[model samples]
Target: MSHAPTTLQERPTPAPAVATTSLSSRTLPRWAPLGFAAVAIVLGVGLGLVAGWHSRIQWGLLSALFFVAISYTVTTAVENKRQAKDRLATSVVWVCFVLAVVPLASLTWTTLSRGAKVVDGYFLTHSMAGVLGTEPGGGVYHALVGTLEQVGIATAISAPIGLLTAVYLVEYGKGALARAVTFFVDVMTGIPSIVAGLFILSIMLMAELKPSGLMGSLALTILMIPVVVRSTEEMLKLVPNELREASLALGIPKWRTILKVVLPTAIGGITTGVMLAIARIAGETAPIMLLVFGSQLINTNPFEGAQSSLPFYIWEQYKIGSEASYDRAWGAALVLIAFVMILNLVARGIARWKAPKTGR
Candidate 1:
């Protein structure tokens, strides 16, 4: 009527399958992506020459080959193990970044090449004054001012509301309020810029307000708010729960803790989000056209009258279909890109400055 004593060997724990997964996945070479890209380019060129389809064949081959390489990396690098997830994630991220860079660099080069002639000092300070046909003269001064004023006002409107909404969602909101805010933010994130412009336009019409920089700003605000809210919300959420708990333990109010700890901790991401939001809206053509009713000359007062943003200027002059107009349009595109780049750089600087310190 006796049972044998239990032993640790009898209760042996199951070995993790995760280790097997890591070994399987991590076997792929780190330099696989570069090799794949090189192969793609070479094969694409060779195949293009063989097929006589030139551009399409080369592009098709290159894209197919490059994507294949990325797929290979992802498949091999992501199998089974959860620990290798960081590697998998980084691999995909770098792939995406490289893919994006090709087009971006091409765009920059193309714009700079074509726009260089018209992007001189005069173009920066002068409006599209008395030059026509193939003749080139004048500048995008008016467009610059218009873009700035419109986007600045839009930022003024959206940044506060978006930040507040994120703050509420992060700090105060719960139940229906939080859910509704999240739902709306998600919905707004997908709203097209053209739709925002139309919404503002419709509202302006009903209210009998004339199209101006102010209205353009409102449209941009609509387009910007969702992005800001989402980004800020994510950033705020990244703040450690321990900090909040610590503050509460110190008898600090929840709101004060968020203000002092959470916001500061996530300020870097928040500022970057704000800049990206601004950049997104600043280049919108439909909103500017619908709200500001594009002008050829400088209108200093954003509140008082019609304005012309860089996008609107591009849209306008590109239609003229003359060399002069074409050159000017390219120059405006370059300027717009430059403005966004500068803003992004500034945001990066801010993010670095405000980034939270690490260490336990």
Candidate 2:
């Protein structure tokens, strides 16, 4: 009866479990990378100066190395090992990107600076006809015209053949014949530009043909076809089989389906590939040298006589080794670069315009 007055004691509850670490606590601040880069640059420059290095390239390389090392070390100290490893990978990638870009920037700047001395309205509008290499009065008009003609002819010849060949490979390819064609295309892709020129030269010799823009066009066509085939084949392969099946189920002819449904779906990539092929052939110096036979006059006719192209013109000018010729060479080079860039830009535009529209 006396034990009835005993009371129960309250037990203490366990504390709620909390995380030991958080993303914000484990990661470096946003400004950390910039600060690390600044410190690395200063140290790299200081070391380069102390070591009596003159090349800015050396400074840049050293800075990159220091940046990667400093980032990894700092990250290790402030965070865990895993985050430090990730930061190290990111730093290396950034360094590689800068290294790749710096050379391109330097080359573009050098070309622009030297090329501007001679690239003017007169330079673009006139030709090297009746002008001495030692003098600075000629222009790239003749070369530009020849380049356009030859490349145009080559494109006209190669595009249809390559596109058709790619279609056959993707749509109806099934046999030893297809395999043989694929093998040859692959072989042609690696064939040297010089080899292509030599092959065309052999044909010219057999036919008693003279060197002209037409001859250059033939050589360029050889180089261009393989590129177009490879690129178009890849693009066509990317088209979904479901669309093809649906088209077939609708009782459409296979060729018509490919022409209407498959080609339109991949037209963007196809056009882009063709443009890339054109650009590849556009810069070929060997073919131009072996076939075009470089003209100094403004021979607008590509098939009749020797004609100049930008690559041949640049080579001829540089070989002259005069200040004026060097300027002309640089100017011609600048023009060629501009031409290629325009082609690429056009390709981008065409690709975007032709890309399949998807409803959201």
Candidate 3:
């Protein structure tokens, strides 16, 4: 038996190893996005040509469709169903983003191209008082002065009142009075800019007063107050109750706590909101047209004489029906856009600079 067992070891044989294939292990290459973009462009152009659609809009739509379809098909072939679906969703979001950006980019490009032709130093510094609409040497100096004064006055009138109202609503409001205030604020928010102008115009007429920058400012203030109040209320509401309670727990009065703890915390948002309101009212042509009465000469004193703003200037120039006037209108539009953009940037900067500190 021992001799037979020793010879039996060579009789057995081993099985071969089995290999596995998993779709999850497969993935698209790093260059896939670039390749997909190039292919989409070609397909989009071809489709546009074949369909006799000459517009960029049609080509863009086709390109987006092709990109999404091709991405899904390729991803599904290479990977599993779940990964392919994920890629499809991502492509859709990217396409939406591109669509949103294209119009804004086109607008900016068009404005810059047309505005650059007439925006010179001389155009910015001289008044159109002596020069005719057909002439090219006049500038926006008079309208610029009127706009600055009127807007400054409006801000001065609205900011304090709006802030106080917001503070009351957030910190001390209750019952019927609060509800009434809120209701009126909502109503005022929806009032037409032209209606605000008319309201002021009616009052001015009752007083036998003529159109002036002060009257324009009164209308702007009417429009701006609701915006400021709404924005400030939202900002103030964002201040944590815990912070207010902590101050009160230290024996501080509610008013003092609001001043010391709440206002500082929300100051950045408050300032930004105020600036936004000012920017909004800056381009209102209706109020300026009704109340300011479009001045051709510089009027530094807002309360005394007729005035003009950037918006009114643009309208006046366009209505003049001359090449020089049209050029000036475009230039004025560019300046107005630049001014608004600057305000927005400044607001963003202030918001970032004064954002709440969180130690990590």
How many collisions per candidate?
1, 0, 0
lDDT of each: 0.83, 0.93, 0.91
lDDT of 1 by residue, 98-210 (tens): 67887887888999999887788888999865656356687899999999888888899999999999999888889997898799889999999889988888898899998
Off by over 4 Å in 3: 1-24, 348-360
> Best by lDDT, which number?
2
Per-residue lDDT of 98 in model 2? 91
Model 2 local distance difference test score:
0.93
Clashes of 2: 0
- Give the per-residue Cα lDDT of candidate 2 at 237: 99
Candidate 2 off by > 4 Å: 1-24
* Tens-digit lDDT string for candidate 3 (1-360): 355545545755678866544534587877887789789999999989998999988999999999999999998999868988999999999999999999999888888888888898987888898899888879998888888899999999999999999999999999999999999999999999999999999999899998899999999999999999999999999999999999999999999999888998998989989998998899999999998899889889999989889999999999999998988988888888888888778888887787668799
Candidate 2 TM-score versus the reference: 0.92
> How well does candidate 3 match the true structure in TM-score terms?
0.87
Worst lDDT window (10 residues) for model 3? 1-10
